[model samples]
Target chain A: MLGALKRLWHKLGSPRWFFALTSFWVSLFGWAALLFLLVGVVWGLAFAPADYQQGNSFRIMYVHVPAAMLAQSLYIGMGVAGFIGLVWRMKLTDVFIAASLPLGMAVTALALFSGSVWGRPTWGSWWEWDGRTVSTLVLFFLYVGIYALREAIAEMQLRARASALLAMVGTVNIPIIKYSVEWWNTLHQPASFGLTQKPAMPSEMWLPLLVMVLGFYALAGCVVLTRMRAEILHREGSARWVGEWVAGRRGS
Target chain B: MYFDSFTEFLQMGKHGLYVWLAYGSTALVLLWTWLSAQQSLASVTRRVEQQAQLAARNTQLAARNTMSGGAATGSEREQNLAGYDESET
Candidate 1:
């Protein structure tokens, strides 16, 4: 098992292998995301019971919670990828970082936008400088900053190293974002899902939420893989295998 | 199904605007992300294909130039130069 795992790890280091392996995964995940999102959205929006206190407005949680969770998770994943790229200098790790940044930025923006919209009805204000809100905003800025840092550098190695370092450093904000609501008085509520406790809401409500969260993950996976494949082609354009691959694609 | 009618479903208990706005914006963002990824992939594929074609063309041109340079005799070279001079005139 260990030997197999090691072999797989080595294989993952090769861009061509990674690209070929994930080609089918992109579409698989795309279809899964579409199905899951459709089911989750329809169920959450029309079938699930509305909140007694907040009413149907609570349905916004379907999109809001998933986006918020995915935003943080993507950042953490990027940080881990950065660490791997710095330590092992695996080319695919940097590809992952570069490919995931824009998606992370978009998801973070979605979370912030959804949160603010949800807030207007619940908190009676669209914007607040509270702990959770501010920390999440900082997370958004961190994505922008890393992306800008990458764009500003022309040398490939320097750009990868700088962006990896920044990604690793930016992880500090994640924990703060996660704990912000608990650490300070804020308009935002506590997390809906936790490992140690049952959800405060009924199964009917949380079930569709679970589906939406999983669907969001699938969506992220699909987009990131597609982008990573593109990045690999961009970086490996001169490689003989890349040329062959393009020729093969043209032939087929 | 939760509401008596589609209108109530849209209304969302007087918070229709907020609920729809959140979902609408989220949908738009998700759509944009997917479309941009597909676009970038297509663009990169086109670029890589173009680079490959350019490289092949360059190699072919280089090979042809080298062959012509080596195979041409002095007379043939002079004849080509004379042809070029006549075209210039």
Candidate 2:
């Protein structure tokens, strides 16, 4: 099983094969993302019971929590992909990094913006230099730095190597962002949902939140795949197979 | 469904502005991200197609010039080469 998994991993190094494989999966997940987001948003916004403490304002959790989770996860993903790309010189891995940056940046901004918006009423302030908020803000800057680094370097190989190294080093922030609430006192609340323990909120509330989390992930996936497909085509456009593929697409 | 009517739902029991702003801004940002990415992809793809067509035309022109064996003029060939250089830049 390990060898089979390794073989599959190696096979994915081929851009043509990877692009073909992702096309079908992208479509499948695209629909799933739409359904999950629609159901989760509707359920959480309307049907779920109001928060006794925060009242209806708590509904923001459905969007905010999921966006925050996605931001963190996407950063870690960039770290892993950067590691692979740097070590193995896998071009596809760089493609993953390039495709993820814009999405990650947008989502991180969403998390911060929404978090502060949630904070305004609860904490009576929009901005706080607390552990979680500060670390997350740092995470956002790291993304900006990665993109800027990529743009500054003209050579593809040097750009890839530099950005990948930066991504690997920047991963130190992910842990800080994750543990910030526990590590220090912060206006930001500790995670209410966890895998090892029962959720703090009631099932109705948490359940929709669960759906929203999955939906946001799927949505992120769809966005990445869509962008990745374009990146792949642009990078591989000169190849003979790409010409055939483009011609075929045009013909169809 | 939780609210008595659409008005109360919109009102969100005094927290309406905060909740709506959060969700609304998030939606707008997400939509903006998707649209911008899609637009970038479409523009890049179109550029790639145009570049490919230009390259093909260049190759065809070169082939035709070679086959005709000096039938094509020097000025025309230079102009074609110049176009190639412009495309590269």
Judged by lDDT, which candidate is best? 1
lDDT of 1 at B89: 29
For residues A1-252, write the lDDT of model 1, one tens digit per residue.
999999999999999999999999999999999999999999999999999989888999999999999999999999999999999999998899999999999999999999999889898999999898899999999999999999999999999999999999999999999899889987889987887999999999999999999899999999999999999998887799998898898899
State the DockQ of every prediction. Answer: 0.70, 0.68
Error of 2 at B33 (Å): 1.7
lDDT score for residue A216 of model 2: 86
Provide the lowest-lDDT 10-residue window in model 1 chain A.
Answer: A186-195
Please state every model's RMSD to the true fold in angstroms.
Answer: 5.6, 2.0
Collision pairs in model 1: none
Q: Against the true structure, whose TM-score is highest? A: 2
What is the overall TM-score of model 2 with all chains considered together?
A: 0.93
lDDT of each: 0.90, 0.87
